[model samples]
Target: MIDIKNVNKFYGQGDSSFHVLHDINLSISEGEFVSIMGQSGSGKSTLINIIGFLDDEFKGEYFYYNHPIHEYTRTQFSKLRNQNVGFVFQNFKLINTLTVADNVGLPLLYAGEKRKAIKEQVKDVLEAVGLPDASEKKPTNLSGGQQQRVSIARAIVTNPQFLIADEPTGALDSKTSREIMTLFKELNQKNKTTIIMVTHDEKVALQSERIIQILDGRILSDKKVNA
Candidate 1:
């Protein structure tokens, strides 16, 4: 579903140049659940941003589906990202003022969807993430796990083909982290949503089907987990 080849990212030009990624080549298949692991300053997040199309100022080719990504206009890029990709950040990016339902339905609002349809889709996703009763509540009222679930629901409500989670469980406790991982597994199995997550936790990484470890702006290892 996504292919990145010979991608290199530099932070600045000339004397300030700091390479964040080095000829990184990666391909994520449809319905694949992949985890990325790396230490501090290892360029994992940089690569994630590149793959997510948030950092377009990189060096190399990124092909989404079949078309070259850079060829798309800003409006077209926005639409494709909205339609195909969803993101969950380390810090839950939910608006403090909006209700959970409102936050989850935000993406659909941008798509110009009908309110009734948006409500239905939001409710379904909330239920899928095991937060049916919390939709009317605000993010501040929910626990860490619930907030992350809200973030997840918000990401998947549009039925996006890909979900990119960066340190999704960084703020949660062990039990909550496990619950979120279980929820992710169920989503992957049931809906076939392609998932790519970046994490520093070993147990969390193990939940994924495959893990790729990065270091010094390059891939160090890639391995499949035992079922």
Candidate 2:
């Protein structure tokens, strides 16, 4: 469902250049759960951002569901991003002022959905994330794991074809991280959504059907494993 070819990302200018990603070539099929593992400065997050259309300024080619992603205009990419990609960051990235439901509903609202539809969607998503009763509460009131669950709900509420999680369990305890991984497995198994996760933990990396080990901004190995 996604392909990235010869992608190179460089920051700064001229001799002051710092390369974040180098000649990345990868393809993720539909219904595949792939994990990206690397140490700090291995460019894992840079690859994620490029894949999710969050950063398209780098040199290379990107195709989404067989269409050339670079061909789309910025406005078109914004719409496609909201519709096709769901991002769950390590920080949870919840709105400080909004209730859990409000934060989860933000995507649909930005997509121009009606208020009633947004509310219903938020409720359904919250329930799916096992937080049916917590929607009305503020994120600050929730624990770290709970906040991460809220982030997951917000990501999956739109039923995106691709779920991009960057160190999804980075902030959670072991038990909660396992729970979230289980949730991700369930989503991939039952719904057939494609999952691309970046994690450094060995256990978390094992949760994926495939592992792509990156080193020095290059693919060291890509292998399939049992989830």
Candidate 3:
């Protein structure tokens, strides 16, 4: 569902320009689970940003389901991002002030969904993420793993075409990380949810169906993980 060709990214200008990505050519099919692995400053984040439609200041041809995302207008780009991609971050980016239901419903709210529908969708996602009773509780009261679950709940509430998970298990302990990975696998296999995750941990990356390793500003290797 995603195709990127000859993509390049740079920062600054002229003599001081810093290249962050180099001729990145990649394609991810619908419902595939892929992981990106790289060290700090290796440009993995930049590549995913381009894939997720969060960055457009690069030279590339990005085709999403045959649509030229690289050529979209800013408004169209924003709309595409809102409607197709869901994001889960290492920090769980939840609002401590809002109830779990409120947090999970933010995307739908922004999409102008009605209150009744948003509530039902939120409930369904929370249940899917194993947080069925967490709707009324504040995020601050939850454990780190639980908070991450809430974040996952929020991300999937929209039934987005795919998920962009950036270091989703970075903040958790080994056991918690395993649990989260299990949840991600279930989502991928059962719901047929596509996942593109960026993680430094080899164990984490190995859990996905395919792993792409980046070195410096280029792809070093792309291989399928052994089952």
How many Å off is the CA of 111 in candidate 2? Answer: 1.0
Structural similarity to truth (TM-score) of each candidate = 0.97, 0.97, 0.97
1-227 per-residue lDDT for model 1 (tens digits) = 78889999999899989998999998989999999999989999999887877777888999998789966677887787788889998888999899999999998988889777788889888998999899889899998889999999999988898999999999899999999999888889998989999999999999999999999999999889888
Stretches of candidate 1 off by over 4 Å are none
Worst 10 residues of 2 by lDDT: 65-74
Candidate 3 has a TM-score of: 0.97
Q: For candidate 2, lDDT tens digit of each residue in 1-227?
A: 89888999998889999998889999999999999999989999999998998886888889887788867788887898899889999999999799999999888888889878688889888988899999889999999889999999999988898899999999989999999999999999998989999999988998789999999899999999863
Could you give candidate 3's per-residue lDDT for residues 36-110 as a string of tens digits? 999989999989899999998899899999999888888887888778999999999999999999999998987
Worst 10 residues of 3 by lDDT: 110-119
| Residue-pair clashes per candidate | 0, 0, 0
Q: List the candidate 3 regions with Cα displacement exceeding 4 Å.
A: none
